[model samples]
Target chain A: MTGVLTVVGLGPGDARWLTPAASEALASATDLVGYGPYVDRVPGTPGQGRHSSDNRVEVDRARFALDLAARGARVAVVSGGDPGVFAMAAAVFEAVENGDPAWRNLDIRVEPGITAMLAAAARVGAPLGGDFCVMSLSDNLKPWEVVEARLRAAVAADFVVALYNPISSARPWQLGAAFKIVSEIRAPDTPVILARAVGRPDERIRTEPLSQVEAASADMSTIVIIGASTTRLIGRAEGEAPYVYTPRFYGVRP
Target chain B: MTGVLTVVGLGPGDARWLTPAASEALASATDLVGYGPYVDRVPGTPGQGRHSSDNRVEVDRARFALDLAARGARVAVVSGGDPGVFAMAAAVFEAVENGDPAWRNLDIRVEPGITAMLAAAARVGAPLGGDFCVMSLSDNLKPWEVVEARLRAAVAADFVVALYNPISSARPWQLGAAFKIVSEIRAPDTPVILARAVGRPDERIRTEPLSQVEAASADMSTIVIIGASTTRLIGRAEGEAPYVYTPRFYGVRP
Candidate 1:
């Protein structure tokens, strides 16, 4: 009665963004595990056991799901964005790899989903047209020294940034600190984009001077920060959406 | 015989990433116009019209498509990834917006597609999980001074970077110069990611120190640069692929 485990990405927010493959994986699962909010995203039906909890307990939840699978329950561990991108996929894998070897034989499949970075990039046009990097601001697991070092390195490298988990109640100052590091290397006018709850209702995305990011309502659910080389504040008239973009090899324009 | 112009995104190189909506848009179009390489990506068909050309002539080619649409050919202005992201979608709109008034009313639909950034991120296992930035090193359309200023600004801000068009035959040194800017403000040992031909059969993605980038076989087709803020180089043992990720939030388990 050994059950298999499949980790799925629900995509940014819209159910339309859900891939058929992901749906099929979840449908075949006897139980689903994820953040309580993310659990609501699964298509509800009878006969599917759901395990939902607060966000802070990802590792514990992942372990719980693995336990179910170890007990032979077909399980699906889901995440809002791509399962691998700052989601539950990696945790599930880590738990399995480090846990008892008995669970290693369980069939594990990872289905990729659209991440917030790409979705937000699309929503705001093409600021991410080229080589860009995404980074989180929270420093609970990693040392702040490490975060600052990377920020300095990234800023010095002139990469456009997509910031995730930019600000939370306990860690509000960290984002501002990161902003200062980038500001030292970038101009005051560099565009800092704030994409809130991308692809979800109540989503808000706006671009402002890099110096003003601290003033924005950056929160646990918010993705914030600046664009690097090649990013520009596109005029609103370019399309229905006002966005930022790093022009890619434009001189070759025919 | 007014023809409609539809812009579609072919998700990150994998066929699985293609959104159903994007697939439907491509199927509905009578003809496809795009860069030669991108045009080849359209799924196989016996009679679909594919107008392909070199990458150098994208603007001319896109404009030509608009003219064809005006002449009543239902043309699909296809670009690899998303059209709006440094691709030809906006160029198409710009051409039409400034073109003859008779061409203004044609139905133009812009469908979101998978961009390279997402494909690269997925391959690397969430290098862009949090706050990040993207930039290009090409100095053809904009002056190097402008590019430098933007780079400096981004550096000051500590954003993770995605570099598009990092090097080419005409501008091989541009990326190096950008690296110099990054080095000015960052540590020499900071992690830099090089993702080549992402999503293609020849895909190569690796993370190394900032100084090693010049020695790498980065070319016009390469996407290069560093992560900022919280990004760190995970051990190669994480998987066959290397990853750089910023910690998620202030208090999440690794």
Candidate 2:
């Protein structure tokens, strides 16, 4: 009996941010596999077996899910944020490419979710309103040089950059390093956004100019949005957070 | 009485992709305002009034919403995808910046949705599995030169590029011109995907080598994804669509 492997995203932290397609996929799965926290986000479905693993074991978790599907056990692999963006979707595909060839034919589907960048951007206003790039700042899988190069290229090209996995225990200085790099290319007045745990009870989104933003305030739950030269901050009444957005039009003045 | 202005995204043409957050925002709104087609996506609430305007008049539409909200109407300004990304969120902010200053004090909120690129990327495997950039090919507001420069910079940076608004009736040549620039920088074997009306009834996602992809097949509703250098295609059972993904590991091999 050929089974199915469905990859779904839980969307930032809230169940309310979950899409109907993702919710349906979760409801239909016989087994759920994901990182412990992400898997726990899904309410228990009767008769559904859940296998939770550590965050570092993405490929292993994906292969395990694939194996379960190969044995005719329907499996759903869950990820926080969009499964396809720095999440389970890529790992699942990586497993399919390298694992047992028969796993290819097992029906696999990926349902997109509201990624952290989009949710974070929404909460803070539209910093990603125009041309933008999303980059993972973690150098765990890739070389540090590669991350810096991509960051420089993205900032130099004037793409509003949304950085994920900015800071962790193992790599603590990357966020500061990213800020320093961006600050050099951008003016001191360029806006920097720190949106942490957006869509969750602990959500905090603040915008500051490049000269004033503190990299230390960011943690793993943070999404760092560095605006383009054209990004603007709209004023608000006293004691209210300002709205930030990058205008749609690109004015190339001589 | 101060009223609320909620900017929400309906996702990419499907009710299933809409987030509960966006849905709740719509449900609580007393008035809905947006581009005509986007405004129509929200199922009519018994007493909620809708103000549909042409797509070209984004600022005008935003000002209208703000005006309604100023008069104590809970207004939701809807967009097709995530409102924060190239949608009503920016337009609303733009209007707030230029219109009556009182609009700034209004309680404005943005609810995220599944954008076209993410939805399209998921339908295929994770083509945007790693660092990626999104750019609109429309030159209506921005000059054609700015578009070309951005296209070149994005391609040269090896960011998997997602092209939105690829071809409109008025801007037929931009998509083709974009392909020519991307081909010059990327390998001929690089994968090109055309995802049209991704979640809607007319959904079609096809992948082709950069060398052979026809520019004319794409229309305004299409999102064109060009693979990064690291993007790989997994072998699939004959007659099955291949899974495309950019691996998490960036082997910037020396």
The number of the candidate with the highest TM-score is 2
**Mind giving the per-residue lDDT tens digits that candidate 2 earns over A1-254?**
47999999899998999999999999999999999999889997999999999988899999999999999988999999999899999999989998999988889999999999998898878889889988999998888887888888888878899999999988888889989999889999999999999878898888889999988899999998999999998888789888899988888521
lDDT of 1 by residue, A141-189 (tens): 6668857876776666665666667778788688888888888899888
Instruction: Give per-residue lDDT, candidate 1, residue B124.
Output: 52
- The residue-by-residue lDDT of candidate 1 on B137-246, one tens digit each, is 66766567857876776666665566766788778678778888999987777777777876667777777787666734676556665766555654433243434454
DockQ of candidate 2 (2 decimals): 0.69
Best by DockQ: 2
Interface RMSD of 2: 2.4
Candidate 2's C-alpha runs over 4 A off are: A252-254, B252-254
Q: After superposition, how far is residue A74 of candidate 2 from its true place, in Å?
A: 1.3
Q: B46-101, model 2: which lDDT tens digit per residue? A: 99998999878889899999999999999999999888877889889888998998
Candidate 2: clashing pairs of residues:
none
CAPRI quality level assigned to candidate 1 from its DockQ score: incorrect
Instruction: Write down the lDDT of every candidate, Cα atoms only.
Output: 0.69, 0.90
User: Which consecutive 10 residues in model 2 chain B have the weakest lDDT in total?
Assistant: B245-254
